[model samples]
Target: MTKKRIFLLLFSACFVFLFYRIYYHPETRARENHDRTRIVTDMKGRAFQVADPIRRIALLGGPTGQVAFILGVQDHLCAVTNTLKMSKLVQEMYPAIKALPGPRTTSGNINIEELINSNPDIAIAGDIDGQIVLDKTRIPVAFLEDGMGEGMEDIKREIRFYGTIFQAPDRAEKYVAFLERVMHLIEQRTRDIPVQKRKNVFQGFSPSHLVTLGGDTFMQERIKLSGCENAAETVTTIGKRTGLHSGLAEVSMEQVLEWDPDILVINYGKPADLYKDPQWRNIRAVRNKQIYSQPAGVFIFNRPTAESAVIFPLWLAAIAYPDLFENISINGIVKTFYREIFDFDLTDLQVHDILLGTYEFKMMKGIKNRG
Candidate 1:
């Protein structure tokens, strides 16, 4: 047989062997028992080894820094990129981070001298590029993938992974429990909505083009949980295979008019507003006063990663079925989030602007006194 044929046969044999080992073997039973004792996840979302980690800290990206600050372990950060700015949410919670020192990571050229200067025990950035950068620095780098588009459960597992690495599994367990409690309640309430009533929602891309997230995107999952149906989430499977998802489909305005969305919930700020033009005024959503603007808050759209997932669902739900979930408190969730995860207090003022699309934006100013 040719090499391709030979390789295919080997792969088939391995798959069969692995399947047999998983389903029928006595040893598999023993391994599963151990897995149950510890938190574990595999590359394919399978429960596998419980991650055990110990560390010094290095962060390579802005979002990683964002998450660390949210976790109340900003002190654990040994290094980060200098370009980092505090998000409206982070500043709302902790304004003291302006003084921290971080090194920026670039791909084209390596900064050997600067790398030598920041003596970090571990490099905790979100990608293999971080590892490559750390490798040049000759430091032990732990590459944490920035799972911005991952589902709620996946985000939780990564948080748990961080806790595992930091030897703070209890903290991870605490986060998991809090997430589960809120999610369980939301799921139960929305279980009654029939298929037809689910809102046909359309997401906005960064203003350069008409690209938007499909149900495959992370934020779309939030849209569904929040009681709205994504118009485009069903159209593409682009985000799943490749972790780096961007450059959405170029759709025409005419197509959007055909969809006749009940509400136009754009993830981007005023710039992504499709209904801004005179031609769009005739659109049903615009005519019905349903065109809504989403200002960038704690993080950007669909970045339902880690702590964002906590607030994301609530924010989406509130927007989708405000009447059904008017009583549900984002402030209460914020308090629980800070108390349980960050061990801090979030003011109602922070919660107000956060949902109002004014917390953190480049152009618009937010109301400081939310109450």
Candidate 2:
């Protein structure tokens, strides 16, 4: 009798536990039936169960700001953690960015008091800690798998989601269409180029041999799209997860020598002082005088920010096949993007410089490819 009772009790407990999980599991949470499913956002095991397609927002990073504008919700943005380097459009709308502040840490992360003061309806952040911040703020925070190294599709999906949320479905559809069109143009332009004729790429982070993008990075993928081959393609090295203090992958002359990349691409802000380094001289890239310095903000993944996504591909197209799209005029691209997304015109060179990474953002975009 005791054994039978015990069995029954255990079965009841299991049933209750499963019932609780079935209802409370983050994975099973569902978004509105009207939401589009073009892009599958893997929300760290939690599905993007967007309740009301989020209106008044608080952002923990700059990308959300860009996305807000892209989705035609520049006015809907209630607050953003002020550490972001804002584009001219954002700066104009929220001049309060100069006064905004936030916590910069990897632990016990909490939302900024100012963000709470703004009384946001929704929150957007990058990590679990950011979610903790939203929890503190008492709002639902959407954590995106963000980075400069993220795929173009991932970015477009984000754009689509933001568009859906802000009731700007037309803008989102157009944005995705434009991205596809631009990418197709770039691909068609380089389709005829043979492997040998293409550039051999070495993505560098520092003049010091320590700098590198791993096999899986968006910048590396961009290089591939531009008809360039990454020197680190065959290497078995992985990079550190820290901000910009990225560690090395077994520093050795032979590894660089074996790659013999024709063009060395480093994130902008690296002072090219490596030309003075004796150790850097032995590098085939250095020897061939093929080292190229990217604009300050063009790195996307290894450097996680929104600016890189806008112009990083343009930089890749310019460097990889200078002949096809050489003049490198961003005026048209910039003008179209501004008009399409925000209905704003950024004509000031200084503003463009800051937005386009003419200055150091002090981070590298992530890697988009693995092999």
Candidate 3:
């Protein structure tokens, strides 16, 4: 009885060892790791399966191409939308992108044949464009959040998502930390300002002086971060669409006179235009000559992008309350951020031009307003 039991136990042990050696060997584990696919859930809550080490990408959405550049994955881009190409600031930073193929227009029109020829490993896009690309091509598509919502978390969320997709989490975390530092600096400086004393800001968008951003867009985030109030905060998102001018709404001249913001940061006409125009003479911003042109960098701060999320609030704070930020050197900050994060060296004159919004004016010259 004892011999029989011992022999059976030994046989069972041998079978267990053989099974472990076959399935859990080092070489087998390595092969599984190499071939394993990852599932990523986009902001829209759709799940997508992506293969490891994505080598080729097609950016088919707004504000994402610039983010790819931020993540240091711009070299892997095989196709992009026309929005990036249309941005004069982007052209200055990454001139090589001019040669890249734009298979999708910013308006969500896709040229399937052109996109197929590009043969990207993955397509990162907005909901509509992403679905269209998924339907038309065999390539995997990852959707992104279209609007930036009410605060800073959404911006960070998008960046981290891109980091995962690009396999550059370290780089993305580094950028996020840097962004938080800048944001904290702005908050510390402006936190002490009394709510009653904070200035009221109105953002006048492009194409028409009366066209402005409402409280629903990222523009409100910029104003609030700068320790100021958005005079247009009461404007509803009744007619908002999902595109370049998503949360923008047109207000009547009577409305401007009613709000009478203390400062007007515009993307269109100059301060002088407001002062001379009889229709705007009674507004507090015009009466006090507190009009300022909004700065434009890789893209206009009309919407949120990685660059805007990091830099726009700081810039706006400096403009809204120069006395509070007297000790901080915004010029140096802008120069360092562009040089270090963007890998683009900015001259002192270039920094000055950007701060004063002259750079935007120069780039926009002769180009009809797109809004």
Candidate 4:
């Protein structure tokens, strides 16, 4: 044969061999099978395809990490919001969380380049522009509408969505069952109480004590489920300016005085601030020292996280009507919850910190008052 013909035969054979290795090789086919994408719908009903073996995840918006942690998928997180990264409780339990890539704020103002570098397979956002994420990063965006609806159902829906993504539906159901049990227990204890006897509770947001949740907000459902009436139920308008929470509304000091809540649950700020402030001295919660701070786990319990949805109501009921929940051990429940849901055993000190609220515990620990 001619040398040219021989060379051509060799080149053709090499091309065929490379093609077989690239496309028909068993390892290559196996990789394709392992990395295949599947369609799943987010809580907002937006359908997107995510890789089957999701190795990395980015949680945008505040406190969404609570769901991932509850599902035992915290190890898969490559990025998280600054709020979660700075959480003392989370940092203690999942030390790696502090080193994860995160945005400065939890408002969904993400740094696209930073997120791109983290190389997450999917980005789950609770409050963000989903289209911007999709166009800029080409990463599938799952919009979590977890806290937007009524109380426990909204939380259950969010957990189920994450469960589906992580292929942990059984674990999600386990958490949901716990929530139902807690709610049932609360109902059984509080059902016979007359409206006149139920506590009038006010949910105060952080930074500004005047900013409170109204009936239009999801917190109203939380308050009701706890067997208390919302003090701000009469005020239906949302606040003109955003503060710690969007559902919060600005009420006049006089209005708060008139409502005269029997108990107060503040997300931030010391109860002493209200007690000492002359402006609030006459308020029933302040005068009676009935103010209780919400707990802080992966996130503040006041937010619509799984921990909040499941535990906050019980915590609220326990505090509001100690006589009714006297036999229930909140500390024991908290310990078991951290163990089973997050797979992290809590020291008594850690549980105390969570129950006392993040800011309060930080104060107790001599940590700076960042809140």
Top model number, lDDT: 3
Q: Any idea how many clashes model 2 has?
A: 19
How much lDDT does candidate 3 score? Answer: 0.78
Query: How many pairs of residues collide in each model?
Result: 5, 19, 0, 0
Candidate 2 regions off by >4 Å?
1-55, 85-94, 101-108, 134-137, 147-149, 206-209, 235-239, 243-254, 268-272, 297-301, 304-307, 326-331, 342-344, 348-356, 361-371
- Reference-based lDDT, residue 1, model 3: 69
Alpha carbon RMSD to native, model 4: 6.6
As a TM-score, model 1 comes out at 0.73
**TM-scores of the models, in the order given:** 0.73, 0.70, 0.85, 0.85
* Model 3 quality (TM-score): 0.85
Greater TM-score among 1 and 2 belongs to 1
Where in model 1 is the C-alpha error above 4 Å?
Answer: 1-56, 82-84, 105-115, 147-149, 237-250, 267-276, 295-297, 362-371
Query: What lDDT would each prediction earn against the true structure?
Result: 0.59, 0.57, 0.78, 0.77
lDDT of 3 by residue, 197-228 (tens): 99998887765687787787777877898899
When sorted by lDDT, best at the front, the candidate numbers are: 3, 4, 1, 2
Per-residue alpha-carbon lDDT of candidate 1 for residues 272-301, written as tens digits (9 for 90 to 100): 355566766776667777656553455544
lDDT of 2 by residue, 148-172 (tens): 4566777777776656556688988
Residue-level lDDT tens digits of model 4 in 245-356: 5555677778888999999888667888778889878889888899988777777665567887777778888898999989999999989888987889999988887887
